[model samples]
Target chain A: MIDTLIWLVALPLASALATQLLPRYATAIVISTAIATSINAAALLYAVATHGVMLYQIGGWTAGLGIALRADGLSALLLMMAAIVLLASSIYASAYFNDNPLRRRFWPLWLLLWCSLNALLLSGDLFNLYVTLELLGLSAVALASLGGKTAALQAALRYLLVGLLGSMLFLAGVTLIYAGYGTLDLATLSRVVAAGPIAWSALALMTVGLLLKTALFPLHFWLPPAHGSAPAPVSAVLSALVVKATFYLVMRLWLDIFSEVVTPQAASIPGVLGAAAVLWGSWQALRAERLKLLAAYSTVAQLGYLFLFFPLLQALPAGAARDAAMGGLVILALTHGLAKSGLFLAIGIIQQRSGHDTIRDLDGTAQRLPATTFAIALSGIALIGLPPSGAFLGKWHLLAAAFSAGQWLWVVVIMIGTLLAAAYTFRVLGHAFGQQPYPRHPVTIAAEEWPALILSAFATIGLGLAGAPVWQLLKVSL
Target chain B: MLTAHWLYGLSGCLIMTFGLRAVLLNDSLLQRIIALNVMGTGVFMILITIAYRGPDAAPDPIPHALVLTGIVVAVSATALALTLIRRLTEEQDND
Candidate 1:
């Protein structure tokens, strides 16, 4: 089972290396790797489900001496989400970049990015996480620059600088932890950690570093341009997987490793920024002119919702209520990962057809591509937290938790964000339904269209309707 | 010995603060990239300092290994950032 974890990371890495040697077969190699890893992810999920939390110590070494790979319920769920989203993105990229010159470069870098993501998700060691983060950051920047346009290059550079800075700060925090505790393993740290200046300082550094990487609220200035200007598939992964990875780290550090050091006052800081992000990001999304920019801003708002879980967790005593809030957060994250990637892919198709992604100008193209438009609508429903979508249920539980805890301020924030999301989502839909005099040219829907449609449908109808299993998955005792 | 550790830690923090300030304040891409590397090096020095002990004691190998890995990652990032910067300059020149 643990050997599969090694292969899950190594397969894509080896394929990435192979793609460089045989660029002609790079597409085939990448697609096969994606499929293979999806199976591997499923197998890992099943193994964890049946066997409970499994920790694979690298090289058969014991604690405090060597690294380990941990797969708990949360890690397994995230791995499966990543596998699904990346598989869909990979399939879409094959058709989306069919005739493009940059496809060769994209396949290799994307595989490397995928490899880093799996490695990051599985890594239980702090230093290993840092290494994987560096790998993920570099590959992500490289993929963003595959567009070869000035805007793309500029966005990539800015992203690289921000990411490097975040990594350095995070490493500094890790240094402080190691200096104080003499261990880099999270499990060991959690057991040994105590409330102290060193621990508090380390938590602050790591939290801020991760917030920057996650692009939560004020640090999110770099996200829109980077996500909006990248190629469609790159944008999908950036919004769906890469940003979420950092947030996942923040949660791990706060709730698990640094739980001993984290005070309620300190926890409320993210909660406050989260509220700000909800209002500010939604306003930005509502005002965005470009379709992709709107989606990018929506990501910021959705990430804000993820942070809202923190205060609820802090407020509620450790029991069913806290677990329910955590489950809601997970559900929202998983749903958003699916829906946002679908939204981006749909926008990509729209851009290809219309030759631009200016939301108001997409009337004719949107009319021509019904499947893609429907994809957007379905994802839009999920994003807006409408009935029968995963986000709807997730936010319901979150709001319930918030209300019960007497945190009415968060209730108001959620209400405002939902309305704003609806406004922005429908803004594109309104434009899509416009009447145009130009004769309808039949648009050939490519193979790429299906992945977005399927994923969005799963998010909207599937997860919304049958979220019990997800809640069940989350119920596995820690 | 305790004074030496404090001095090294304090200096590391100062170097990091300076590097971070430089990175944030600079408008030039090269300066920002260089500043980021400087910031990373400061962190590495701190890790090394933490690993240091008395003259007779063997230094902890963990931070040494970590610093080595950090250097590789930092170098790769710097190289990639430089390449991107060069491309940006070329595109601007063409424009």
Candidate 2:
């Protein structure tokens, strides 16, 4: 299992270097690396399921002294989702960039980004997390600018700056922890972290830094442009996986590491911001002119739903209810990761076929590209939290927890957010039904379309039907 | 008791605040990028301050290691940002 964990990070990194050296075979290298990582991720998931949490220390050192990689059920599930999304996007990207010159550059950076995601998820040290976070940020920014357009460059620059600021703040917080607790390892820190000034201030600094990166409401200004302007595969991963990585760290600190240090009031801070994010982001999505912009803003809103889980979990005591709520959060995150990536790939197809992504101009798209439209509809259903999708189960748990905790405000926020999500999702789908000449064949370009369709179906139908194990997986934490 | 840690820590906080303010408010791209570097330096200073025990004693190596790694990351990020700025300027000039 530990070897599997090591290979999960090593394979992509090695492949990244290989692609850099052998640019001609970059496509083959990327595909093989993707397959290898997916297999490793599956093995890791299986190991976690059978054996519970697994921990690995580097260079035969102790936890407090050496770097550790820990994977419980949560990280494993996220790793699996990331692998699925990346693999699917890789297929889409291979076909999308068939003749494009940028494909060589994309392969190396894409692998580096994957490496960092895996590293960040498995890292058991706070300082190690910071390093991985920086790597993720840099690779993401580089990839975002791959389009070489003015808009893409501008957005990438802004993203790079914001990312730097966030990392600085997070580093300061980590320094404070080192000063107070005398250890950089999460397992050690979690045991030693107490409710006091050092803990409180450090948590505050780190949370704010993470919230900035997560783009929760007010700080979300840089997100739409960055995600919207990036090449489609980049945007899909950025929205689906990159932002969620930081949010995962925040959840780790609040729920797992600093559980004792965080007050309910402090927990509600993110929840309140999350509520605002839900409304504001959804409203922006509703008003966005372009399809990609709408998807980007919808990302902001969907992320808001994840944050809404914090306070509800805080209010619930340590029991089955809290566990169930946490499961809901993970399920929601997984669904969004799959569905949003699918939507982006489908939109990418639209943009490529029509030379633009203006939602207003998407007349008769369904007739022309039935498979892509179906992909959009399936992902849209997942996004709207409708029945048979994992998001529905997630929202059901969220509302139940809110009601049980007597937090009616969050209930109202969730209701409004769902309605707005429905409005925006259907707004895109509504364009599919416009009158135009239908193509003779429904599926054009099966390589590109199938990946999006499979991902969306997985999120909406597969995850929804088989969500029972998610709660069980949540119980297998360290 | 007034100590070296106090002085360095306070100065670090002040510098970080100033850098953050400039980064937030400055319009010039280069200035914002420099301010970000300044902000990173401040955080590194605090980490160094935390590592300092006494003149005679050997300092803790973990924070020092973290600071070094952080410097490398920051330097690369700055390079990336500057490259984007250069390209963007050229693009605007062409326009």
Candidate 3:
């Protein structure tokens, strides 16, 4: 299991270097790395499922001295989701970047991004988390600008600045944690962190920094352009996995480290912002003129749903109820990661085929591309929380929790957000029924279409039917 | 109560506030980027202050290591931001 953790990071890091050195075989290298990492992620998940939480301390030193890699059920699940999404997207990217000179650079940066995501998820020390966060930010920004367009470059620059600011604030928070507790290890800090000035201030600084990076509500202004303007595969992962990584850190801090320190009122702050994000982001998506822009705005709204879980989880006593709500939150996040990536890859296909992603102009193109359109529809169903989708189950738990907690306002917010999501989703699907003649065949390009189709189907059908294990996995911590 | 530690810590906070203010309010891209770097320096200062001990005592080594790693990250980020700015300027010139 420890070897699994080491290989999870080392494989991608080595592959990234190999791709840089051998650019001609970058595609082949990335494919093999993706397969290898996926296998490792599965092994980690299986090991954790069978043996509970696994911890690896580097150099045989204690937690506070040497870096530690910890994977409980939650991190393992997220790691698996990331591996699955990256593998699917890598397949799409291979075909998407075919015949383009950009593929040479894309492979290295893509692998670096994967390495950072794995490192960040497994990092047990606060300082190590900061380093991984910086790596993730830099690699994401570099990838975002690979489109070489003015919009892409400008958005990538803004993203870099915001990311830097967020990391600086996060580092300051870490400094305070170390100053007060004399330890950078999360487990040690969680045991010692109590309610006080140092704890409160560090919590505030870190949450604000993370919220900025996660782009919650008002801080979300930088996201749409950055995610929308990036090339297809880059946008897919940026929207799917990158933002979620920071949110995962925030969840770790709030629910795990600062569980006793954080007040319900404080938790409500993100909940309220999340409520606003849902309404505002969905509205923006409905009003967005382009396909990619709508998807980006929808991302902002989808993340808001994740934030809504914090308060509910805070209010619920630590019992089966809280565990269920936690499971729902993870499931929703996983569903969004899969569904959003699928939607982006599908849109990428449309963009490549039609040379534009204007929502109104997608009428004939949607019908002409049957498989991609089906992928979009499947993702749209998951996004709207329709039945037999993981999001439906997620939102079901959310509503039940809200009702139990007597939080009527969140219920209202979820209802309105769902309605708005339906409006926007159907708005896109409406294009598929246009007058243009439908393609005779279902699958056009198997390499590209299959990835998106498989991802969307998993979000809707695969996880939806088998989501009970999610709650069980949530129970398997050290 | 009034020691070098308090003074340095307070100054670090003040510097970080100023850099954050400029980064938020300033319109020039280069200025914002520089302001971000300034903010990072303030953070490093705070970390260094945290590492400080009495004149006779050995200081903590963790914050020193964190600061060094942070400096490397900040330098690389600044380089990336500047390269991006140059590219944007080149695009403008072409336009």
What's the iRMSD of model 3?
0.8
The DockQ-based order of candidates, best leading, equals: 1, 2, 3
TM-score of every prediction relative to native: 0.97, 0.99, 0.99
User: lDDT tens string, model 1, B1-95?
Assistant: 57778888888898898999999999989999999988988898899899999677899998999999888888888899999999999999999
Weakest lDDT window of 10 consecutive positions for candidate 2 chain A: A469-478
Q: TM-scores for chain B, in order?
A: 0.95, 0.96, 0.95
DockQ of 2: 0.86
- Local accuracy of candidate 2 as per-residue lDDT tens digits, B1-95: 23998999999999998999999999999999999999989999999998888898898888888889989988898898999999999987887
Ten contiguous residues with the weakest lDDT in model 3 chain A: A431-440
Off by over 4 Å in 1: A436-443
Q: Write the per-residue lDDT of candidate 3 for residues A1-478, one digit (tens) a residue.
A: 4699988999999999999999988889999999999999999999998999989988899888899999999999999999999999999999999989889889999999999999999999999998999999999999999957788898999999899889888988998898898999999999999999999999999889988999999999999999999999899999999999999999999999899999999999999999999999999999999999999999999999999998999999999888999999999999999999999999999999889999987877666888899899999999999989999999999998999899999999999999999999999888656887776787888999999999999999988999998898889864
Superposition error at A92 for model 3 (Å): 0.6
Candidate 2, A275-311: lDDT as tens digits = 9999999999999999999999999999999999999
Q: Deviation in angstroms for B12 in model 3?
A: 1.2
